[model samples]
Target: MRGSLGRRELLKGTAGSVALGLTTGARGSVSAAPEAERRRAVVIGSGFGGSITASRLARAGVPVLVLERGIRWPTGPNAETFPHMFSPDRRASWLTPRPVLTGSPPTVWRPYTGVLERVRGVGMDILCGSGVGGGSLVYHGMTIQPSAEHFTRSMPAGLDYERFDRDYYRRVESVLRPNGIPDDLLHAPEYRAVKQFHDHVAREGMAPYRVPLPIDWDFARRELRGEMKPSYTTGDVLYGVNNGGKRTVDVTYLAEAEATGRVEVATLHLVRDIARDSSGRWVVRADHITTDGTVRERKRIVTDALFLGAGSAGTTRLLVKAREKELIPDLPEAVGSNWGNNGDRIFSWTPLGDSPGALQGGPACMGVRDWDNPDGPVTVVHGPVPFPVDLGTTSVIGFGIVRPRGEFRYDPHRDDAVLHWSRSYDAELTDRIRERIRNIVGGSLADHLTNITLDTSAFDTTTFHPLGGATIGEVCDAHGRVLGQRGLYITDGALIPGSTGACNPSMTIAALAERNMDEIVAREVGKVF
Candidate 1:
């Protein structure tokens, strides 16, 4: 808000509401002008949550505006939208000179306020997406539905697990159209990481099975045949697949939503604030950022409803900041509490002496699961990994589950959503998970296998899946309707209370969003919340 061009005053409860009308400005810029209110909705952040919610609503004939803080990642042969994993460009990050990653020190670990961001918090560094497609741009394509038992453990009470599995999860999968790693591709040399792990685990008396991935295998086969530039073959999973094989949100929900012509996707529009106007409509303030990272225009949207689907960090931070700034009173005390790393950790495993091949694949596909162990409740899953720097050696990343939650605090001076977590936050739980990883390595690998290395040693503090804050039955009702606030809803990963068992959290996140939209649409059209 420091450089924003608008009235700084927010909607105080006692004060009358204020409206800013649209006006032509510098370089053909425009501002908000209150007009006849329509039954319009605004969904913030275009990840799985935002995409699904916006798409379904538009399908139901509701005019929707989707505000995404990140740029629209391009596709096709001429598209150079993403950065290389090895030589990461500054554009790979959000307004930073370099890619902000795990093990970042204090100077780089700044509390985030910009709605468009790639941020890290103390002991819990998070890598969230900042583009139209959200984290789908950077995440491993692995998707799994958590076991009903473990899913219930992390989930807040009153969520009917059986119904979700039977209806919601199935509904999401029907659209996602996930497929197991192809039989032919797994035999390829490029997929040595997966094949070797699968074989090794089976030898260890564990029945390792193929996991479902959100990638289009048909396109991958075309790449393997040298008909096009490689995406999966080149290990372009983390930074994004430039060749367009990945079935990201852009290719699915967003594309379908745009086809309806009733939805508008505003990319690079940083949603700065949300408050109520006098008439009880929602005010959405978005900073229109150009390619050069300059704020070109301050655009505000007046809508009948607003959905905070800006992932866990973005949504939590925005709501917390709104409360702290007094823009919204009665913002729940649980707004920033019960958040955690999802027991996510990254450590390496390499062959004892032999070259572990290129150690490059589609970033992730196969992971070792030991969920049946009586010693602990953790899953040490591996991914199709890489040597990032091309060190000629292999590095396999292990993601383990540990159930510890953290909270977000609003710092007015910095105008940041600060997360306070320590390495020792859940020592015992972390140890249990790590030891399981060690056991998997020790019991499975041979003498030549090198033990897992510490690398930054801060690996345990980072999380790709940051869950909670504005969670169910806490900051919001079980249906994601914010308590004490009407005409507002939440549909994103933040609705997840904590971990999603040993699986990647995206599938569960989307499933929950699907269920949220079903309820929201019914309530909006007729049924009450």
Candidate 2:
């Protein structure tokens, strides 16, 4: 069952606590302290990969500094930033107010293109969070490991996934503390809707699965106080979850990194470019935006170690910008190409008579994985809806399609990405998947059912799950080290050269970051200074 409090009410209830924790004396000391020693590694973009890198590096006794382009989003009354997507000014900015680009890359770039071609083109939303925690602040917090098939087929050679996953994936999961919904919550009426749909698929002989959420079990229990409120009931996570049900990097790795006193985060500071010095160290140029919106150019403290975790857009932009300026020459031909957003589509179903709750809240928890066949296109359902379950009045189910290798081109003329994605060649496969969904929903509800088809047109603008621009193998080597560049690394979604079949990208990104950092620590720690 849903909680007594409306979404707004839940925000009001949790706002005070988040504010007290996120914005207090925690960050004051860094701003007040004098310039510290130069044994530091400057990290660009504080999203999941960057945050995890900073934390792990700091724990290893390396002084780490994180530079973020967006302001430190506070979980205050203005936490209204969480639901800005449904706001009247939906088209005002490319992303939420906090500087996190939640929409997928292609969808976000579509308006700039002015041409919409569905066939032969794949549409993916590359959603990325900004601010101190990066995407962790806004992600659905679904922590999933990439399947073995992904590593064997998608990952580049020389990269051993067997060793990497065994050594580093667990560490990443431990830091994030992903949790599964209790059986009781899963059986709740809101969840039942999703389960019913899954059952229908199973009856039809499809492979369906449950979503693994990154919620801290104990913390969530305490917050609920024995009540039946869904964890996702308070804030709209697709924008940003201010009440902390989602375990963004700020609350996870970055927070722990800060406690060690070896890490510092500078929000609202955008990294423009990076260059290696004559001594082989790296110098990063950045633009720092003040609270009043003033932009000032600042040079980051020089370091021999640099990590770039600024999602696909930010990371690609920086690398491309740097290449254009000759900061690093002899760049690879594939530096800014082969990008893909998990081909995604949303489908909404209206259930019969007043369902227990609405669809306003609930982690994307159930899905079907029929996309694993090499002979056929793979498909996976993350989960079903739970709260705000009034199908006629308020509910919808969203499914993500993982599309492989669409082309990405950089347009220096427009200072934007020109992407061409198409699935026309796969029409038969696409139709088959669509039919599967139609049949399942039809079989489950019988008489009282209203189905809504959501093409790319339904949303005023589309959002993204992952975007890869400065992709791996093309832009950087196997270990995230950019080609023709020393002391620089790329460690975000941009490094994902292709899709991971049916899985969420966050845990995969985090695991890769951990693996990359381990390599850096083993080889470069003493050389940084």
Candidate 3:
């Protein structure tokens, strides 16, 4: 069988994919059953949840094995690993044979597996990421934390808002080092779009409105000076940033985990199932996929403890099937319930007259928080499309206090989780986003929506932030421990009972992971340590 994590390629020029900003670790590639791995803890899916948990576990001297389904994104000497947004190559998708298009027309585009992974649910078309860094590889590096009041509706009752706001948020910031684009750069010619929205929000008297991101400031400056190629300004985040401009988890958390000499990160290890053996230990079944999307071997890994950090869609699908097959029959009734799309509305405005519209300016740099009514809440963040749209196209993405919840139940015929949803579930949020656009750009020709694109399925929209399934106070305990199963925990966005109230959920996911690890370490692995 072929190697799993691409360790064999480390000696070649492709090693940068696995260890982006790390200083240590043997950094072995994934091998299919080269030998059985027995760890104190086995963490599945290396996104925000798995990355932070593995880092904490390794630091505490617990042996950890992190299984990531996608292959490594090795940056060549010229940063060739990450393809440009307009010209996405094989590295862009998770397992598709080509770059799959989700937004607007040109429905069936190219044919190459790149970073953005498309999971076609029965009622929805889900977009997720693959690779060692997981979602971090493809998402905009925004770290917007929701106000404590926004956390009232969902999540565990009587949560310690003080601890989360002060301690956990700071913990995430300490690692991510997010900062607002300097005010000096705000009015610069290259940052016109960023400056434009900043002024709009400021003039509209929006509360706590600003763009905070984890982009490399110096790298952006170089790119602005034409010394570097397009990273953020030219739609770099849409695919994956080829330059060292975006600081994702692989460079930060996973690197720290490897430095401890107690963690082994194995990419291409797609976790498939979980079952309890005779001795009550956990047995994890997985597919060790190669770089070419070939399954080299089916590996069954045994561990003392297991974590379901794959993500909302990923973890929910796995657990729901496991329950139906009686692998973990004691799973709770809320296993596949309380899921949402963050009330997302993906609409764009292309001005009527011929004017050089703004193109991609890296990650989302500004947001408007004016529409948050205690009665009905919503937050709209203005983002750029950065490309052929330069002639006028711009993205209008919104996150509302949407409470419409959907559920995922295993479909025997399809052998996948089918989401129960409808077009009417998003009508309220969509109308709110339209009003936000009108208010923010009232005088501009963009006040009225033009060149709109709708999901053909049900005129439904898409969202990168899919939250809840096996959530806290429901599927898992307040501390993220699954009720029916001990040693099996969830520490991802799946644990967030609802939307993050107009802000991006990455920081909250990381902070909650930090909070959960504090509990998991003290209780579950203290004896082993």
Candidate 4:
């Protein structure tokens, strides 16, 4: 196999291809026997945290192995590497019988290792990405850094906001290279909805600033100029971006780690359990599966150091299950505590007057930051839905400060950790967000309909950004080292204390991972690895 497969050159058996250059030994069929392997360090899930951890450790001369549950999604100028939003198939969901998105029809789909996973919980359902790039692949690319005041309030007091803004945040931005949408692109004929949103915010006496997105603006410009396909221009990026522009983790951090020849990323490796061996080393049990959800092989990997970067839900589920099963007997009490949905509320906005064109240029280029609100800070961003015709509808998503009141309990019958959340967990914050949206466009007929009709416009019990559980300062130390477990760590949204100060968690997650890896590489390289 080649050391690195070009993004354009992927296996072509399915609609969504698997790029196996980093996965040197993965198979398509069942193997003769299970495989056993050992590594100096093992990182689970190749999202922002895992990719940063692998890159940093590999640079420090540590050989690392990364396990991802989903297949790679490679893209180029006009590659059909991902499923479109309007015409989704099995490639839109991960082993789900139907599409995960709310408005999607209940069409039964064949099982495949798709990009998105919807983890159903009490009172809410969480949307998590499944592939090598993890959430970065499916996210709207809103790279936001929380303000210092809110950061200090939401996070552990030890994490210096000034230091992160100056150093680690800068590090993440330098690599991701986020940019706001240029004015020329925003004023394009297709982006009428974005302009409408900005005008509404301005009329409501709020400043609508362009959000920094890790996307190549030129790609969108090219689509507008008829040089390529209309992925970004039409906002048809719900599954994954087909025409490569978004700087996802696989192409940035993971690619760099693989280039060092010290990191091996294994895709289609779904981790089932985690425990410690007799010699105090970490033992991971996983299944190597085909894209159709059939297990091809079972594998055991033992490592001196293990980092849980499988996101808030996945990591917390594994830890909680291990704790209950007594596989890892001495886990902390906070392993399943302090879980949250990041105070998420997504609203569908329909204007009364002018119909914003259906072709809304996106990756969510603009937002209104209401940091001064006494009801707790909130950030609302405008996003475009990939509808082919003018529906006069768009989406506005809000994030705010909500106390983490969700927990996971082990279910023996299912042999898994099930999330338990109250319906009233974030009721107050949800109200604030709803009111804020109403005040933004109050006199409109849409607002009147929202007021009279019993609709989900006020609150939707779903979150793309699930935070906390195995949180920092509770389950782990300030530097993400688990207090009771030696050589075990957390380097994902699971480390955040339920929220990212009213902003999306991606930038903070990346920055915090950079900070934690810095301390870890400096202190524990020779001793732990």
Candidate 5:
């Protein structure tokens, strides 16, 4: 969930396969390597998909090298490894002069290797993560499994929801260990807003369900007990939860992969571009940069197997740029097509007479799944604002089923790819969902609401959940194997066909990768790598 500051307050906030030995470089110094380093497997981006791929491949007796563009954020009790929502610094953004918030005014700062990056496209702006754990580092930890009907409706055919629910989905859950908010935590004094949201949902004749979150409630409880600094309980998770209990991919999957002693994760290595050599090997060009964005070393890595898990924006841009530059021949024409914003809409609602309390507890716990609607399925989650003073406000973010109408086009002048989404891309469906929310909060109690403002952070063609571009079935097969390029694969959100039903894409993306890896390892382990 993308957290937004109050609208009246002026808004704010924010790889391959193969096995081989890795080389080392000097810290903060340039390396003059004569030739490209060779490896058996290289996985780009260390989020859910890449981490899972590396873990599975390593378990299958393959040595893996994982490349992450951002530095590692190691968090502990009271550790200030991440930026706070109210006091953002250079560590809050990726390369941008200011935080990539939609409605916030630009405040310049020195560039650094930050956690989040905003890719500004023509009609849409994508907010993606940049650290070792990728999007999981900043996501609200909503690990939702879409219903079978919705899954079938949005995803490409040939995926069996039954199998996914039984196997791959369980695989992800086993690692992330997602669970509902404990009763004690939800009923605590600090979580009055969450309890109020549940009461409101029940009063509106709808049952509120506890959203499954990959978080350790104990850490939050400790904060309440004054054993740690306030993070989750304070709702200061937009940037990240400083007193980390979040089971982000880096701490879960990537950690396990590294523990196997077969995986090496290179941090602060920004991938520039990718191509295939004459001998049919994958060549990845990257720049080893310092925390201040200085390129210390230019590296050329050749691999036998390559997996692209650089999220939707990063993976899409790399493929689109490679295709336009004629670097990778016969690339899929659909490399930059079928992108969607996941029908994301953020609303700040303040009940007329009720105070939802200040210092709302979160990483979201309560939501309503209105899947039975005839028009289209929609899911709404209650978002808690972490403010020190009561503003009589809380937030609700809605996700709806929408067509993938956005496309990414290569911008030769900028030497990059830009998204082209129509202003009215999913207007009807999002409007329908908006009406559903309005009815729930404003219908009979319309006069009882003090205010309801659509946050421009999401309303202004911006999305925290960016899906598609190099989507499955168009650029790759059902198993994530690129159609024309053997040993090349997509194991990230980019493979998702625009939306993961009406749910967030994390669970589905990881499940799909698990399914793909099951086939890839069984069929082409020793043979390919």
Candidate 6:
């Protein structure tokens, strides 16, 4: 879409700034500074993980450059293509098209139609982000941590949970600022359904905890005080909200990091390949996509460190391609193996009467953790919402559980990833849970919660949470250091060991990134670029 700069323009413009700190050799080739002074890290994908990592690195005084494949929004030259789907003032962006599915045991993939089809196989909907903030700009902000029991049980034996909690998890929470919604506010109709579901579980002698969220309560309190209107409560968040609820990485970490002046984020620069120079420095090849439908491949950047925080699918595909091309051999066997979608299942029902606060735009504030059983199938029920309007008549109440039946592997022939997953439990088990939800919703407001089913067909279309692949273990030594690769690291959902029982994944991912960085900073490994 953009034109590649010729050698003449490159010598005096953007490339000149990059070449300032380097030495020019034969044939216009540039070499980086010595190891002692070269202290920059290149982060790909500016979603939750990448954004947070970049911010921390920059704050640490290590110059960090973020290369995002998507166009930057609001201020970038290509911002016009980056549309806000949920904006009340403007129509939605047609970039993300819905899919069409048929039959039982459905095949989950992008549908073959609309603009989404053009980039479908390239990890489109399941892992697509073509703007400044990445998915954080478009995801529903529901952030929850897994229970201690869930984390300990799923983690590999060698990982020290005590060390992990002390080193990484705590720092992550501080930056994310996750908080639990108050019980009283949750008594509203929508959350009442959530509480009722918990009540039913309690009646059955099962213990369920309220879901923790990442919303800014102080801001919400102001909105409730009439000082500010509930901006997020007005609509769905998957398409981006103006000034609403939870603190996305863009509004939080990235914004603050940019103020430091040490960090620079270049959007629309899609990284194509990573190679190591003769001197052991890292070189990145990128393609700058422009709005005019032209593709220009120029600008090779060399840095000392690199962080692969490009989600599971995106990061895994890049690594697999690199391995096949012999760019980086000796990658751990755990590069792209363990993968899980957190056993996502949406159960919908139509409430007979109108429900107040049902259309509120907050991401699920509370959930019934009643089914978080280690010995059996664990389930969590989310509050009802007007978004994703079910059957065109009824509101939808959704729930997801962590299932272990998930794996990620690379398909070199297809140049893509094969995500194989299934319901961790039988239909009968899920059906019983659905019935329990229906009964609870029915009893809570004197309205019937009808049309219940356990459908996997939805995965063929959309997902709010996706996890695993490049999981933690001896292969990476817990802190996400791939055994042999010296300067390479992974800090994304790909490092999640397994499914987080009855929990949303954004908080967990962000938390884990903080932890990984703690290890990196502790070792002083990323200090020299």
TM-score per candidate, chains pooled = 0.87, 0.76, 0.87, 0.92, 0.92, 0.73
Q: Candidate 1 — which residues are off by over 4 angstroms?
A: 1-8, 11-39, 77-79, 102-117, 388-401, 444-450, 453-460, 526-529
Q: Write the per-residue lDDT of candidate 4 for residues 1-529, one digit (tens) a residue.
A: 2211211111111111221111212335543444557788999999999999999999999999999999899999999988888788888888766787877766887777888888877677778898989999999899999999999888876899999989999999999999998999888888888888888788778898899999999999999999999998898887888999899999999999999999999998977777776678887777677888776776778789999999988888888867776667788988988988888887777764567668688878888999998778999888887788887778888889888889988766555677788768887887888778777755466556643212252354678888888988789999999988999999999887678999999999999999999999999999977
Q: What's the lDDT for all of these models?
A: 0.68, 0.55, 0.68, 0.82, 0.81, 0.53
Top model by TM-score, which number?
A: 5
Residue lDDT tens for model 5, 228-334: 98899989898788887899999999999999999999998877667776678888877777887776777778899999988888888888877776667579899
Model 3 misplacement above 4 A? 1-37, 74-78, 103-113, 203-208, 353-358, 371-375, 443-460
- lDDT per residue for candidate 6 within 7-94, as digits (tens), equals 2222222322221000101013233321221337888878888988888887787778888755544422112322233222211221
- TM-score of structure candidate 3: 0.87
- What ranking emerges by TM-score with the best candidate at the front? 5, 4, 1, 3, 2, 6
Worst 10 residues of 1 by lDDT: 17-26
- Which candidate model has the greater lDDT, 4 or 5? 4
Give one digit per residue, the lDDT tens place, for model 2 in 1-529: 1222222222122211111101111111112211312436888878888888888788788888888766555553223434343331322222223222324232221111000111112343344454677766656666666567655555555677777678777887677677666766555554555556556567767766666777744433443454433345422455554445566777678889899998888875645455554567676655455443344333345677788887765676556544544455446667656665544444455544534244533556566665465554444453333333244422333323344456555444433344555555234444555555665555445532554333332442343455566666777877788877777889888887545444566777878788888878787777743
Give the C-alpha miss distance for residue 466 in model 6, angstroms. Answer: 2.1
Q: Point out the higher-scoring one by TM-score: 3 or 4.
A: 4
Q: Give lDDT: candidate 2, residue 323.
A: 53
Give candidate 4 misplaced runs (Cα > 4 Å): 1-35, 443-460
Query: Alpha carbon lDDT of residue 437, candidate 2?
Result: 60
Looking at candidate 4, the ten consecutive residues that score lowest on lDDT are: 6-15
Q: Which ranges in model 5 have alpha carbons more than 4 Å from their true place?
A: 1-34, 103-106, 445-459
Q: With candidate 2 superimposed using the best TM-score fit, by how many Å does residue 343's alpha carbon deviate from the native?
A: 3.0
How high a TM-score does candidate 4 get? 0.92
506, model 1: CA deviation in Å? 0.5
